[model samples]
Target: MRARNLAVVLATIHRSGPHTRASLAERTGLTKTTVSSLVADLLEAGAVTESGAVRAGERGRPGVAVSLSGHRVAALGLEINIDYLAACVVDLTRTVRLRRIIPADNRNSDPAAILESLRALAKETTAEAAAAGLRVIGAALAVPGLVEGGMLRSAPHLGWRDVRVSDLVDMPFEVDNEANLAALGELWFGPRESDFLYVSGEIGIGAGLVVQGGVFKGTYGLAGELGHVVVVPDGPGCRCGGRGCLEVYAGQDALLGDLGSVRELVSRLESGDQAALEACRRAGHALGVALTSAVHLLDPGTIVLGGIFAPLFPWLAAPVSGGLGTRLAQMRGAPPDLVVSATGSDAAVLGAAGLVIQQIIAEPAKLLGL
Candidate 1:
């Protein structure tokens, strides 16, 4: 019961920011003595700290304001994308202390070699965090594939299958889908929306459904397979053995192949290149078609475009919104809000860090060796 109270006090402070003991007591519905005791315990645990005094409107003595001590505990977030390996360290306050991304073509490289490189990156990130007076409590690996029980079941983009995360990296870590991690990152660090569909565009497309501020991973941890959703009948072949999949139309590779590089694509779009405009419009239309199904099924309050999609959102939003608005106009009075991801390319890595942050928050006693 004490631990639960401590958690409540800590959570209240975390969500509502720095608070006086009296305010915390009022907010948590706990006695002033209980709140003071819990706050003292939390301060001793280094989970929180006194952030000076809060003025009492010219009435009495000032009360000390307590805030979370983010630097006391940090977590490492590592990501393996088809074209790059990245790492980031984040503290309890969701502040990124250090981050590095090395571009590598993982599609053709051996998985073992890739893991070695990622391990090196992890070591470097940990060293940097240590230098900054932060301790890494845990690490999580974000992969562009299906993850189950810390094992990667399949990554068609990387041609890897049935690989345990332990075998790939010597360090203890959790594994998760990149899109799912991105969704979690957005939820924890962005606007804190309770429900949304996060669509991540990269070499391939994927989506993560966030319901009530939690990721809905489904029965087999494969709920949001937005990439494989068919946008056109017999349109194009996808790497996933499907025709007319959304990825085939709106993925980075497809867009790059059609319009050269992203820089060039954006340039052309800005210059009113007819071909670029047409391509974006088509991609947007296809994305809209796919999201229409998602909207109908999940009925999320918001749809966030993330990853590579974030940069190109300016071009894609109108068409995608048009598609969704057209398709869902009859069913719902208002279409779900469409927004670009605030985390952008960093969403997965930040989410990876958040996984550990969340664990620590749920079990603050761990920090005290209790």
Candidate 2:
């Protein structure tokens, strides 16, 4: 392996614990000499510095302590959903620093609008970071669509198909399905990014899945279309040419069908309006029904709730719990518990930011100037 690449591997081990050169070599499957060479490179690069000397209780020379430089890189994330767009700045650790959102109109079949918006938002986030003395290196955009090979497959609500985002957005930006980014955030924050499914309920519904730490994107980019999983064979027509799709009942518009807006609907539900309560229960039931199939197939450890509908989640908790309760009862145990995302709108944006960081880590060769 290249010494520079191996140097990163060594630094990672060092940050993880007090590892010896032998242990680093063993962990990375590199020769002792290779590890030593790489460690020397790291020392020279200033990406790693000896913290002090560790005195092992033995005859060996005192071990040198090392730590990562962690250059304080900042990233930006943007979430483009059905009716709104969210932007946020995050650190390499996926912590959101600040965020903003605006109403999005997906008309004219023009992805250009989104491109312009992303550039402006990214610039704004960079300026904000600079003012705060932060250095931003990359950005990630999350969209409610199937993303494949730098292209958007088709977002039924966004009314865009086969669009190339790489050509549209500016430098150091990567785009992916919004749910996937949510899953990333959840994975890092959840008990762990284990075999789990993430359900994001907003103006539209989408899913992100992680079987292990890695995301499982099916043959096409639209593998985990859990939201579109039919809850009822003939419940209602969905824009995606399906009947009883969960989105028709649990999506943002579903909660706002006859209301002023989703925010007001949340308030009504909060007040326990019998009508609003019923609607929330129905939405929950539909969500549970769709989830039943996924739970059966994936058997995820947990399900995460996010987006506009998160606050109304408590209203639907009973139905969701009941649905999962009855299903899991067949296997003899309590139902899987649900988690409301504390990240809210910022989650998706930060998820997008995580994408860029993940990319740079996965392919360091693409990373310039250390």
Candidate 3:
């Protein structure tokens, strides 16, 4: 109970920003003495630190403000995409300290190697942070497929079944679908709009739907497979054995195939490349069209976009806005705000750390053995 109380305090501080002991006590319904004791324990554990003095009236002892000791708890997050393995190291507050990307070359045997590489990267980053006086506590891996019970039941692209992540991960690790983690990221760090669709346009498109501040994962893990939605039934073959999926139309390689280099393509688009502009417009149009369908069906309040393609975003707004037709776009009554993620490219890593925070906060006993 003591550990659990401290976890609750820590999680609350992380989500609601720095708060005073009185506020945490009131929020958690704990006694002031209990809150002080837990805070002291957390401070000693290096899980939290003092920010400054709070002047909420000098009626008593000056209240000392506290914030999460992010530097103390380094979390490594790995987003395992179809063709790439992106690893990131973040603190407890979801601030990414380091990130590295590796291309997944071989499909059949790359999963093991990729997992191993991510562990190694996490180790290296942890060592560096340790030299700088920080400690890494845990790691999280977000895969592009169904992950339930902390096991990859199936990844059609990676051709794996029941691949227990612990077989390759030697450190404390957690796993979940990339889209779900993205949704969690949006909920935690992006907008607190209560409802939003977090779309990830990467090598293959995926979505994370948040309704009323919680993820709607349906019965299966494939609930957010927006990429597999048929844009054109007879357009192009998709890796998911689908014909003319949205991913086939708007995925990374598809965007890069017609434009050559992805970096150059992004640069030219930013610098007013007609073709680049057109492609993004097309993608945005398609996404907006898809959002239109989603709006008609689910009626979400906001549609938040996050991923590598976030940089070349402003140009895609017109097509997306026009495609939505101004009705049920986003924000309910106002025009939809089709903007890139403010959390930058490390949202996934941050979200992964958020997952750990969430799990630990909800079930404090799990952190005991971990």
Query: In each prediction, how many residue pairs overlap at the backbone (N, C-alpha, C within less than 3 A)?
Result: 0, 0, 0
lDDT of 2 by residue, 13-57 (tens): 534745656556667777879777766765564344455677544
* Each prediction's RMSD to truth: 2.3, 3.4, 3.3
Q: Which lDDT tens digits does candidate 3 get at residues 279-313?
A: 78778777776777776777666677777557656
lDDT of 1 by residue, 159-267 (tens): 9998877654444478899999999999998985578899999888989998876899999998888989999987888877879999888888877775546778888
Model 3 accuracy (lDDT, Cα): 0.72
Clashing pairs in 3: none
Off by over 4 Å in 1: 29-34, 55-60, 167-172, 258-260, 367-370
Q: Highest lDDT among the candidates is held by which one? A: 1
What TM value does model 3 have? 0.85
Please identify model 3 stretches exceeding 4 Å from their true place: 15-27, 56-58, 103-109, 159-161, 191-193, 258-260, 270-275, 326-335, 361-370
Name the best candidate (by TM-score). Answer: 1
Q: Give the least accurate 10-residue stretch of model 2, judged by summed lDDT.
A: 361-370
RMSD of 3: 3.3
TM-score of each: 0.92, 0.84, 0.85
